[model samples]
Target: MNDEARGAFATRGVGLAGFDAPEARGLPPAATGVRVSSASDTVSRRALAHGQEQLRDGPVADACSALLRAAAGLRETDPAAARRALLAAASAAWSAGDHDSYRRVFAVGPCHLCGAGCASTPCARGCPEAAWRDHRIGMSAMAQGDFRRAIAVLEPRLHQVTPRAETDELCDAGSVALLLGRLPLARRLLSLALASARAAGAETAVPGIIAYLACAELREGRHAQARAHAEEGLVLARRLGQRNVAADLSAVRALVVSIAGDLPTVRAQVAEVLAVAQPHGLAQAAFLAEWAQARAELGAGKVERAAARLAPLVQPGARQGHFGLWFLAVPCFVEACVLSDRALDAPEMVDLFAVWADLGADPQAPAQLARCRALLAPADRSEELYRAALAHHERASGPYEHARTHLAFGMWLRRRRRPTEARDQLRAALVGFEHCGAVLWAERAGAELRAAGEVAGTGEAGPLSSLTPQQVRIARGVARGATNKEIAAELSISIRTVEYHLRNVFAQMGVRSRTGLAHLLANVDEDHGRGWELPDRG
Candidate 1:
């Protein structure tokens, strides 16, 4: 329990005339401190808001009031329960939207900044609208891959926004809007913000503006303009000495470079960005940049490395909050699963979409979610998912985003052996990648094209061009017929997983059987580090 609670209980004597509750005598009381702590921040505001409702209909006030007390209990000792309380409070606030309800439900809950009257101090200070609260909630929702919900949580605050808020929060909202294809909204908000930032000479805001302008231009299909704007942002970020902003700008640069088909540069630069961002405590920047880097590794013929680097960041637990949490995490996770040769199950869009509905973001998330499902579904189960992803992307309206969804569809089609449809998707994806400077992605698409016989460029096969010393060891083992089990045992894998990798090796190498693989393997020598020999099935 917290000091207050300990003190509250310490009055065990009952004889007191109350003398400032004579300081609790002894050690720092080893309990978790608060039944729920940080209650003063995110949760208390919600409680205070709940109090407002109690003043309204006596019944709800009682229910929520009781809920608030219980939440306080949880707040000091168990934050998880506290968060649930806060979320419930937020839910009630939405249901009520009245001054009392809004205050008790959101404003007075923990995580509240400034004061219950946060709106009152817009002119004098830090962050208008108290963006930290909204952004945190929105980001938490997004990190769970709940963009529709994030928009819901964030939009009310963003709409008719006052220039008094921090620039990053505004930029974040615009970025999410652009990703969702709320074009008209994105344009209005972004344009206003950009103009305001520029006029204010807030150089820090330049990067945000650059992002908005580039993203806006890309949505309009003004591809070249998008590139230029992104480039301009990078320069401006450097001029301002804002490493985080520069890193974000560099991510855009990587995207642009990827679009230009400069795969090597895209690979190198994204890695640099990841390296630069990881140590700065800039979790959002690090996660985003790392994701791009992993994708680049796949494009560069280093599949294993990509898998290791990406798996954690995309996991839901690893990305509880930040920004674009879901939109950013889901696509990258899905992409990682497919490229890394794993089944797409846990946390698939279908599952995540359900969670979104429960959270009450955009109601349409479920319907749009069906699109991604159809797109990823078995060939026979797909017409629905395909249309959904298309609709979702169109609604998202950003070409870069649309292209990614299309690329996923192409991967599905290719898997289904519908080369014609697959080629169309792959081409569109490459164009998006090319258009957005996702060079590494374009390279992968080029490989798929060659595999489909529409073109003749190496994708992940024909040679191991980008393998590092570690990968060379692993690849050589596969080339020598070492099963993942044997390779794992030799390199240390369990029997089952050995078979799993064997399947992937065949698919990645474009071979149907061991003999065929052996034939392909003959071209390489031990110089790069050969793997253990395999037992011939023959």
Candidate 2:
């Protein structure tokens, strides 16, 4: 251990020199004030201490065992402590991919002592105890495929989580919320826990919370923010000697870079994650690493390579990746398969993706699923599917994906000898890609536009072209004669933000008034042969 790690362990009363010595087993030499009334208490305390040491050192599977022992020893005497220990054990087991150990932790009922279960008590809504109980029951229900019950039990509990909740309770609730695909709720709860943990100097908890927070941001299409948090979390995890958390953070970085079209960075991050994740049985991290690599390949236009890379991860049976994450790769897999002349191999994955999409967790899934179906549909039917995909994209915040749909539809139109229609979609796609910093995708769309007999515009293509996705939406709202408050409510943003983007929109479009902006947009729509629809305020 390094000086920093030793110092952290020292704060827990564990000395660095004799951590593994038989005589230094229970309560380190620095421990003096601890009270142990019974043999079980002493053993439980020792086991808990040892488990924490192992977590900070190496071999998390062993840490799970130690924590489980601690929980069992304290089950009857110290129910609260036992519950904490068990939750810790479950986390360790999950990281180590120890299925039996994880199941064992969950099998120990919601309450450590009460056989009547957690519902029997009339606890206040945001209490730490109630939060923990809800987390446990919700997780168990999810494991059992009772997703409806799980969401019913956990969604309300997420709202109940407050700054007053314990760090562990907050982390557990946030993680559960994330797994259920509630990105906003997960981000809010995890961000709160992260701030609280940082303020409390809880270094051990910060890395994990940051990992989850990065994932939530990633899912929400905040790629830049996700990468920033992932990088910070990686540094801290490595410094704290938490290889598993470091691997997870590295995987997150890989995903972020993959979307940004940084192939070299994606490969490097995936390599770093896999070197630790594969041997440590960190399947979630490993899955992410491999998925990111495939995504990078797809973005680089290596269709066959991407399809081959994703095969094992998304296919059924033992070779498949993490259950929660495998479906995420299915859209890419379907597109790759179609592009590689292996369309027959895509239906199963697309069906699976649709099943998950129906669960309504991932906001991008519906549009992506539509695109996948469009890829597999006949040319006669593909246009309607692509249109449906675009309609779905209007409701979500993922510009990269929305652009991909436009790009695909444009490509399809070009092949059908409809250059004019193709040019419109390709132009929108190029703008979307450029606005989102997807350089490779933007180049692809530009090339398509050029091939369709149009010189790609050097800078802004039109008045609305220079505006961002949000800016464009706000401009459209003005054209539709909706007030800033109406647009803000429709977009779930503050009216202040709506006004801010609107001012930028007006400035960019060279229009001082909403009436002028609306007239300008109407002229552009007539020239372009398409209409930009805003949310219907009526």
- Model 1 spans with C-alpha error above 4 angstroms: 1-183, 208-227, 255-264, 270-276, 299-303, 316-327, 344-350, 357-376, 404-538
Which 10-residue window of candidate 2 scores lowest in summed lDDT? 15-24
lDDT by residue for model 2 over 1-538, one digit each (tens)? 1444333222212100000101000101112235445986988989988887665445677887888788767755676777667766766665654545554554424332233244324235555455555555655555444556667876786787787898777776677677666778878888888988998999988887888788888887787888899999989988988887788888888887886667778888898988887666676678889999888877766667789999988776677665445677889899878776678999766766676666565788899989999989987889999999999999888788899899999988976889899999999999988877777678667766765768544233477667655576678788988877766543434689899898888787888999999999889888878655442444
Clashing pairs in 2: none
The positional error of residue 490 in candidate 2, measured at the CA in angstroms, is: 38
Top-scoring candidate (TM-score): 2
Error (Å) of candidate 1 at residue 194 is: 2.8
* Local lDDT at 145 for model 2: 43
Report, for all candidates in order, the number of backbone clashes: 65, 0
The parts of candidate 2 lying over 4 Å away from their true place are 1-37, 52-57, 97-104, 108-134, 457-538
Tell me each candidate's RMSD, in Å, in order.
16.1, 17.1
